[model samples]
Target chain A: MFGRKGKKGNYAYTVARVKAKKSQLMGDDAYQKMLMMSLPEISRFISETGYSKEITSMTGKFTGINLIEHATYANMASVFTSILDSATGELKDTLAADLERWDIWNLKIILRGKSFGIDLDSIREDLVPAGVLDAEDLEKLMSLDVDDDIIANYGRMTGVSIPQSVVAEYKAQGNLAPIEDFLDKHHFERLLATIDSRSRPTRLYQEFIRKIIDTINLETILKLKLEGIHGEPVMKYIISGGKDIDKKLATQLANAETIAEAENDLAQLDMYEFIKDALGKDTHSLKDIVAGLRRYKMKEASTFSHLYPLSIIPIIDYMLHKENEVNNIRIVARGIDAGLDKEIIKGLLVI
Target chain B: MAADLGMIMIGAGIAVGLTGLGAGLAEKDVGAAAVGAITEDVGLFGKAMVLMVLPETIVIFGLVIAILGVFVLPNM
Candidate 1:
């Protein structure tokens, strides 16, 4: 919704607060302690940390992993909301676009929930309104029964254009993947378009985004490779505007008959080193590969933020770190609940 | 001699004024970030105070130049 004109932003103040908040996020030691704790014990431990307020408020309503999951979503939404509220001018615009990932996430949840006839309250619990969309907007979406009407309302509210053909395909096949892919691609495209790359810092920010898009595209290809589906299906999910891993490379990686061939193609890229170990392992899961890619993205963000502390990179870094923290806690809680081994749980964490 | 003195005074004024402006610009960013840090953690107030005053050195240097011009240059 923001225009292309660059305005003065409160980067110093916002980034400082963000960095302080980031410093308070849980570290490896906390994760280790939580991994050894029981479900209730984990809940208690989480209650003692940043999520205390969220957990205490919901204590009577939910418990165990369910409580942890919902409380994390609540905490995430409030955290993002407060940050967005505090930011001014261009910074706020960039953050809103970046956090729109969560909007896409909430949209996916609503779509999936409505399609499968899931209960409204539980789906609401799963929704993290960390994006531009607020709880009220989500409530309106939840009240709508038809997917098309919900999508239409979302477009009107957010000003995001969803092609009729994509919606028609989603309707015809009853599949949500295409819709999800389109939304994600559109979000990144919008971000790139709104950014005027004339300034050096913004140019760096754009480069950072391109790197992330590349990693995401790589992750998608690896996922499709593992699923034994290739060619057209994999190509359909490829997002445009990446630095590397364009259509040609993506096709080569996707159409490779053997994983080794795909690895050979990937080895030529700079990012391959970051993910090589994950890809080379005999027992590689898409989860492990994705975690590796995410770590690299985090690394890139940190370096960029350090290089330009006054830029938007620091805020993006803080956001990524906070999201990782939430995801890590959820993983530990859910892993314990599922009776998964401790080592396995450790493997799944991006940290 | 009086006109020369007047010019020297004007030069001194420019030195101090421009430097003061620069210092204010520098401190605007630092002070803003410092307050932001302090809000998140009260314990950081002392550190923030130190950083917030760091930019004051620029203005101090400017003041010294102005002092030199006003007190020493004329005497020289």
Candidate 2:
């Protein structure tokens, strides 16, 4: 699969295929249609569309809204599998490793949800299958009791993932906080590891990851302020991989009386435009940062598409785009079921 | 003087032939991409086909050089 002919030109073929797939993703028209359906109707709709096979197989075992939920996971897993299956280089393996963020997410969700005695099926449905964890493995994970499974999984993921101390923190606090922080930290770190050193293409990818980390930290800060947390305690929660957020700066931002001041402080970076967009004048929504990450990654992928025609970048780009597409579809489907406005649902979509 | 012309003609042929290799290099990706696009959406097939063949222009230029037999013209 590593085979690729030397092109005076870079990976245009892979880029072209990725571009074609991106174009096939559901746009506003479908998003609008999706907002009008009930959960059962959504399942039927997905059954008729690209996600049909997923919906059909799951329908008999689980029905109604849960069908849409499980089928969403199935579609996400299938898409990730397709991308990994299609990938062709050393870069392919690296990209796949980065996508393992899903495992961390799944483990946390299972541990925290079960700890609170939430039903397995409901917790299972909330997972976004954008990572390397298979549906069977996820089922195995979901079946286990919360805290033990978390520690055991931490040991399993230790060499390539977060260490045991973090899991110990989870056990100690009995809260998902530390474990979730570790997962976010590892996700960004893994993204940093995958880039080619000193290349413009990889640098752009790295920046995108960094920006996302910073955004998440900012959101955490916002959440703390809303809860009236103060001083050094809130500072401890900040993840360290963001572009400009060091320990002291993170704490200061968290302690700020107004989130707008924090936004203003972050406005001078090269990604000034994106920071501005995320902060949105007087009212900041770090949710905007999450959306910004998706957009930024798309821009980086398309920009790099002209290089390494059949290399790993296109495959990675396709995977990211596909995950985002599936998420948007689920939102639209759920929004429709919830009787939300199409325009409002559209605003909520990350696509 | 005549020998110099023969040498230059052979040199030009090699140069032009290598250009086909360059064109071939470009074609592989374009072709694969076009095919993949067609698989996803049939409507893109025609336009993708046109774009995929675009690099073949390099080969055409090389062919023109060979057909003219640059030797037929004065060495000036």
Best by lDDT: 1
Docking outcome class, model 1: high
Chain A TM-score compared with the true chain A, each model in order: 0.94, 0.81
Against the true two-chain complex, what DockQ does each candidate achieve? 0.85, 0.46
lDDT (tens digit, per residue) of candidate 1 on B1-76: 7988898899889988998888888888898899888888888999999999888888788889888888888888
Residues A1-351, model 2: lDDT tens digits: 124343112334445656677777667667667777777777777777678888878878987767877887778777666655554554455556767777677777777788889997788787755566566666777777757665565546434445678767877887878867767776667667766657565665565566556656766776676566756777776767687676667866776776566666656543446546666646555566557655765665655554643555666667677777778877776777777877888887875
The per-candidate count of clashes, in order, stands at: 0, 6
lDDT tens per residue, model 2, B1-76: 6887787688668868887898877877678678767766789988997998899899888877765667454435
Off by over 4 Å in 1: A1-6, B1-8, B73-76
**Ten contiguous residues with the weakest lDDT in model 2 chain A:** A1-10
Candidate 2, which segments miss by more than 4 Å at Cα? A1-11, A128-130, A244-248, A260-263, A266-321, A339-347, B1-9, B70-76
For residue A81, give model 2's deviation from the true position in Å: 2.1
- Tens-digit lDDT track for model 1 on A7-29? 65788898899999888899999
The C-alpha TM-scores of every prediction are 0.93, 0.81
